[model samples]
Target: MGVLVWNELSRYVSLTASAYAVWASFWGMFFRKFFWDFVGGILRNPGGIQCVHISPISWAFVLMSRRPSPRARVFITVIVKVPFIQIMTTIVGFFILALEWPLRPVKGTRFHRSIPLRIFLLAFQAILALLFYQGTNASLWSLIAAVFYIRALTLGESIGPWKEQRGTVGQV
Candidate 1:
């Protein structure tokens, strides 16, 4: 199950190799989709957004903490909890990149004007996918990417830098 979920994580791995990875990841998600459908007892059911295992932060905290039949509740909790953990880490990883490396150029120059953030993210995501499996834990990579992305996105505009060059206070 973990491998299936792990393999399916590509759907969220939109950082790089987007075109190709998308298809692969989509199929991966499809597997989970069915499992979720079965467990949820319906198709297209949705779950709440919750923080990782440190509950009180979990959406199901009240529903899960106590129950009439602990076994059924436990099973239900595991199903949702597992996915929650995966998504949490994935989001954390994405932000890690978002905060540090938006990869935007500061001035209207060669790379800034030419490169699209999507293309760059596509490549970066691909690299991260590889790292996700072999690099270490997802949390580690998530933090790494978060740092890289935040810097790039936040200060990537070249025009803003140009404003400074022109002695204008461009509050970017």
Candidate 2:
């Protein structure tokens, strides 16, 4: 029972964390005017950037922009309502739902039949996240995820910038 309870909690934390990531990606700013600057600004001052502890799912990832440094309750309150963040999470949620391909069920369904698998996948992801959140082995996994995320983000941006620099997609 203890394991099951922990599992469920971890799963919720995973879902919440995923939502937060999408939220940050979309609106860490632009909502209540979340201002953040690397060169040192009020929104994201020199020390504003720090790892925020997200309970049950420790060490998720919070940019910690501190233009004003509101209280915890207030900070969370604002975050959940941020326009960009909410929209981003909504879009992600919709995408995941759409992945189920509910529109055309018959005619030899493929991914539709795998809905259970999808849920399980989500749960498994939650478990992995839980490990990072509270396990003693958290640091290593977190570091790895961070590195991979950075590399992917950099590569993704590079593709577009490279294309622009070449003066068109294939004209380079």
Candidate 3:
């Protein structure tokens, strides 16, 4: 009975991880399209705007006001709501990056981004996924989850250097 519960839990965990990996992959791949431009807009034009108001009700109204067909209007609405989401996401990202070499000072390599450290994070996640497997019952689900996670990580890594030049928010 204990073994049954453990395997069941493992299966659930694997499924959740797979879902997370897919979510991460989408965010990682389309971050620029979904977020960077909006965030870039905020940072570049900080001009005396000390506070931001995020109104979900207003956003819902905006969405309802549209004909619900044009991609451009949907994109604009998303952009309008993005700054709030960006704040939370950026905070999480900062916390994660802060644990690494370039962000936080450690024993070695003070000046450069640590490739080995990044690789180690990926490896650790893979090992974690392997640990989720529970003998013959669990099968390849854990491994598949790990693969997805690793791909998401790599896709995330592809979005390098978040800075945009001053006063160039919407320029091509």
Strongest candidate by TM-score: 2
Q: Which residue pairs in model 3 clash with each other?
A: none
Residues 1-172, candidate 1: write the lDDT tens digits: 3323321132233343232333333333332321322232322225432222235565453422222233334433433333332343344345424422334443444433332353354345444433222222332333343344444455552212223335557755
In terms of lDDT, the poorest run of 10 residues in model 3 is 130-139
Q: Which tens-of-lDDT digit does each residue in 99-169 have in candidate 3?
A: 33234353244222333343344334333222211111222343443344445455443223324358776
Order of the predicted models by TM-score, top scorer first? 2, 3, 1
Higher-TM-score candidate of 1 and 3:
3
lDDT preference between candidates 1 and 2, better one: 2
For each candidate in the order shown, give its overall lDDT on alpha carbons: 0.35, 0.36, 0.34
RMSD of each: 17.0, 19.2, 20.3
Q: How much lDDT does candidate 3 score?
A: 0.34
Tell me, by lDDT, which candidate is best.
2
